[model samples]
Target: MSLRTKFMLALLFTGLAAVAMVGGLAYAGMTKKVDSLRRERAAEHFHASVTAYLAQYGSWEANRGKQGFDAFMRSRGPLAGDRPPPPDDERRPPPPGAGRPEPRGEPPYHFILADQEYRVLLGAGVYKHGELLPEAARKNAQAVEVNGRVVAYVSPEGVITPSRQELQYLAAMRDALWFGVAGAAVLALVLGVLLSRGLGRTLGHLTGAVRAMHGGSLLQRVPVESKDEVAELAAAFNAMSEKLARTHEELNASHQTILTQAEQMRELSVRDALTKLHNRRHFDEQACTLFSHAVRHKRPLSMVIGDIDFFKKINDQFSHATGDAVLRQVGEILRSHMRLSDLVARYGGEEFVIAFPETELPQAAALCDKLRAMIEAFPWHQVHPELKVTMSMGVYADLAAGTAEAMLQKADALLYRAKETGRNRVCFAA
Candidate 1:
């Protein structure tokens, strides 16, 4: 069952048990009181009957009445003929002066009578003739002495047993008590069911919100209806969820920013600062990878190493700033003239290198001569009209040159030879 139903059942049962216990206790107390009253009335009737019987009759008649009393006792019938027995010693025949035996069986009326010494004389029902009476019956029973004999007596005022009317009344009361308990229990059940349903609905809303959050929707919230504790709990939970959603968004933004910065840093690390080209470090790495590929594929590879002729003299005549400008201009020219597949880099101050994949030694030399002629024909004197610059180029082609460094050294040697012969010219290795 749902939580609401279970809670209602528990509350209803508790109310029912409580009402039943209270009704049972009340009924028991009332029944005891009524039974006590009935016993008291019976005692009073017994004492009165005995007293009246002794007062009207002489000794002989009284003796005769005793026989009647005995016969009544022996009859063992209903209340009509019931009587108390004579004393054990007095069970014998009466003395000569005693009167006729008492009428047989119990008298039509109830009475009690005691003699001078408080010994029983005559009695019926709950009281003995001469016995000391209980406190309940003493007030109503009359005290007397007949012929020097003391007696206490009472007459029956009403029936001393529980009447049919009283029984019916008690039975009705018991039924009413049960009915009241049942009615109260049903009312409690209804109230409990309503309360529990409200509580369960509140909990269900909270549960649905939690499930939505788990499914990646952090914006869900529980509904609040009352100003009770459940409403307060829902408010707190909504606040916490809002905080978590905001924190998640911030973390994601931060992570994306970090990733973008890392990419920029990687690009900066591989690029030359002045020339805006791959630096010597990056070129060396590429050259090694390319050389391995060329060896594996058995493809021709060629390289060019070039240097500005009399570069130190130009720097001394002008200034380092002009020398740097010259190098930057030359880097731009080389980049523009080179094919897309070729790699170019500033090797050092006034020195540069280029890689040409799938090119023979003759083709590499021709390309180097074209680049030399292009650099020599450029109008350098326009910016510094008194200055002139020239470059010497060397070409090398061989995959089995042992290493990229070895191939570059060979190219460098050829470039030194070209400078020795004349600046602004290309030279090829034997």
Candidate 2:
């Protein structure tokens, strides 16, 4: 099932298939060759028998009188009626011109007399007597001549023929084929099993390593015991796994860095440059969320909008550096008095905004009054020793407010009114 096992099985099967195919073809070819050789030998034997029989017949026909030819022809069996008699028979002292006695009913002898040229002469066989030869016997038959006369004859019984030799060779080939196939099959099976076992063991180790990797054990590796390809594959796999683990760690670190940078960017976008407090942009975004929560959860929310009194006069009298220090001090004081849940932002130059969740307008106004009194009492000249600062504060509370914008507008209106009435005072939105 594992890669190594699969590979081994693939190789085993491929070898088996190739061997089987080639072995089968070899067996077939060998069978054909052996059969051909056997057929050739059988043909030789048949030709030898036929030749020997013809020589004896020819000698007897030439030397013996008509009696010998008659006896030989009779012993050999029938022939066609058109065959001429032997020369010895032809020279017989027959009644002058008695016209060769009506040849005995289709003479027992069948001979084909040769022409003066002594080439192949007429021939006959049992076939002419209406006796059909077997395929093997027919193939064994050959034309011969007796005393320069042609004859057709077949080998005696038990003589080898092409078909018989072919059958014998085929039988031997079948036996050999079965033996080779069985031996190959056994060998293949044994090799396949042994290879499968080795492969299975290797794959088992790889599988275990993979499972460990899945379980967060990145250091796990497959065991390698050889210098084969599987070992190389294991090494490569381990390298890849290590690389992936390192890459994953790097990606995680990068993700954390991005998150940190994003948080820092958010802070930078919303903080006042001099005061280091939430600027107007942050106030707008947070105020909307706070307002929604107050409306949905029925929680009181309050806002305090304040402006530094005579801030431009202070900057003009001293310097921008002094003005900046004053703003920084005010931001510090505000932050010190606020709880973690409260938000304080520098709304604009010399203006600050404060938000309180679950605080009523009266509580927010009282806190602003406290902040005003503290600023008035504190010695700003300790650091500058020459500057004095005051702020006008306005407070508003959520009453299921028309909108966050409307609430901020109301608070801003109060802040302006406080500044108009006096430079340092706290006002509340009715």
Candidate 3:
């Protein structure tokens, strides 16, 4: 297929995929919401029915008697029946404490009445009245109680199928989904064709510009009248053509100047602008090289991760300018304390990392402690009389540690431990 056709097909596919994903997620969320609403309503109904019944008869003990059971059966009518009703004993209610058999067989609703011990007193299921429900089924089931004690459960069996209103809602949603899919399909086709035509025209302009440039026309430029991606490309091409013409004119005089600018840009790329310290990118590059050398030579090497404590509080209480000043001071201290063989960098924010070559864990720990003490003792009166700054440090040193990444991670974890235990401390592991 042509490039335009392919691009159009890709756009169509992406649009359709997005629609399907959104529709599926929306449908799932709606389904969950509907199910939750149904359960909530069912629970409300169950509670109301139990409350009204108990109110009429007084307590569970009163309901356990023959009069109560008969009254309950009559109230529930044939729906609550599990077997032929026992012949009534009008002489006296079954001796007090004697239990009534639970109902059995499937009914429109399943209700169970159990005692304090969870033994079923009456149930509306096929199980025997006294049988225990499986633990899995009882999870999240609602309870009924008497005198501030749980005495029964009313579990509705089967999925609470959608009611008529919910079914209508689902049907409407399905219709909307179908309509959306149809609309998306048409939209995709129209957008695909338009984009293909536009891209084709833009690419044709680019091709002609390249041909003119190849024929030694350095001043040739692509017209850029819009802010679309194609226009951006055209603007970039025009700039390049202009640069080429200028370069051809001053190739001898500007060569050294260009090299100096390139070097400055490279330095800027790897240095933190605020603190004038080597940034994380530079740190990673240096760390990999140093770690490899240490490993190959079987020399001890230690890594340290440090963070300024209460740095955020300082920023909140003082201005951000003060925070930046503090960071610059900290960076100066770190750089001064480091030897030519060691590396230090502003990892990010108030955090910094240092790598020590030919040094063991104990030596690194000692150095970090010294640095922490120095930072703590620095006269913050220079900035604010009451200001106090401290740092937590963690060091890891193991020549056999397979990767630099592993050592860095260990040091980070140790730094977290130091922070958790108390601020302004140094912790180390070998």
Candidate 4:
């Protein structure tokens, strides 16, 4: 079950058990006390009736019979079957103890009656008429007095019969008990709802926070609305979440720093130190991939090898610093003119290599010729009085050469032929 439901049920059962225990005990104790009081009042009233009867008649001689007061009791009691007809104006006087209301049923407790001489007058289904009351039984008998003279005695315990008044009181007490139960139940339900809702609200916030953290948001806050244990737990959870988020951020920053350093190291490994272009190692790897792609897709591919003409002589005639300037300028020019798809790298000292994907021999050779002319027209006289500079490039575009290494070798042969044929020119495999 949900947390709210479990909490509500726990409260509801607790309230009910408490109310039931207390209410049931109260109702039972009240029932016992009420019965005791009813029985006592009945005994006292009966005693008073007997005393008045003797006072009017002056003896047991004038009762239902001189046979005994049992005669009078049998006459007025339940076994009489039917009551006598209404008295006429000339009717005889009413019988003894006839002043009581009609009995709805059996009396709550039957009684034993005796004269002042301790002679049993009524047995109450326990003793016979005119029997001397036992000494042991006489202890429980209450004296019936008339004008300060004891006339008879009455016993308080015998048959149990609930009269109308007793039943009415008991029923009222029962109703009150039921009402108490119902009220307690309703109170429990209301309390359960109220308390559980408050608790559920706190739990809902915790649940939502956890879910958000599960998603990409690592930081969250929840309300601390109370000082109860639940509130303390929420506070603890908030602390833990904040710490976790902070730890995650730290880990991410460290990871990013490591990745950046690794990337820089990788770049340095494959880059030429002086020219800032890809070195031969990086070029060979990319050239192999480009050659494979061109051969696999049956697409045009081109390879070119270019050399700075008379580069060693320039270094010998002037200083190598001037030659370094020329090489940097030429590498920059190649880098600036190349498309994103082209790969240009300094192959070795004063030499360069280029690979062009998706380019035919004609387009490759024309591009190489343009680069040669640009290098020839550069103002090299600034380096020395007679200084001059130029480049020779050989273009080879044919995947039939089978590998990037083989194609570059063919371009190198063409580059040699270009240097032999002319100093500042581009030669192609035409």
Residues 88-127 of candidate 2 have per-residue lDDT tens digits of 4555566987776654422422332222233222224323
**By lDDT, is 2 or 4 better?**
4
- Judging by lDDT against the true structure, name the best candidate: 4
Instruction: Score candidate 4 by TM-score against the native.
Output: 0.68
Score each candidate by Cα lDDT.
Answer: 0.74, 0.71, 0.78, 0.83
lDDT of 4 by residue, 289-364 (tens): 9999998899999999999999999899888988888888889889999999999999999989999999999999
**How would you encode candidate 3's per-residue C-alpha lDDT over 159-226 as one tens digit per residue?**
35455567788888888877887788889999998877878777777888889878977776777757
How big is the positional error of residue 146 in model 4, measured in Å on the Cα after superposition?
A: 26
Residue 85 miss distance in model 2 (angstroms): 38
For each candidate, give its TM-score against the true structure. Answer: 0.54, 0.69, 0.42, 0.68
Worst 10 residues of 3 by lDDT: 77-86
Q: Residue-wise lDDT of candidate 1 within 345-408, one digit each (tens)? A: 9898889999988888898889888888888888998658887888999888877797877889
Error of 1 at 46 (Å): 13
lDDT of residue 108 for candidate 2:
24
Best by TM-score: 2
lDDT of 2: 0.71
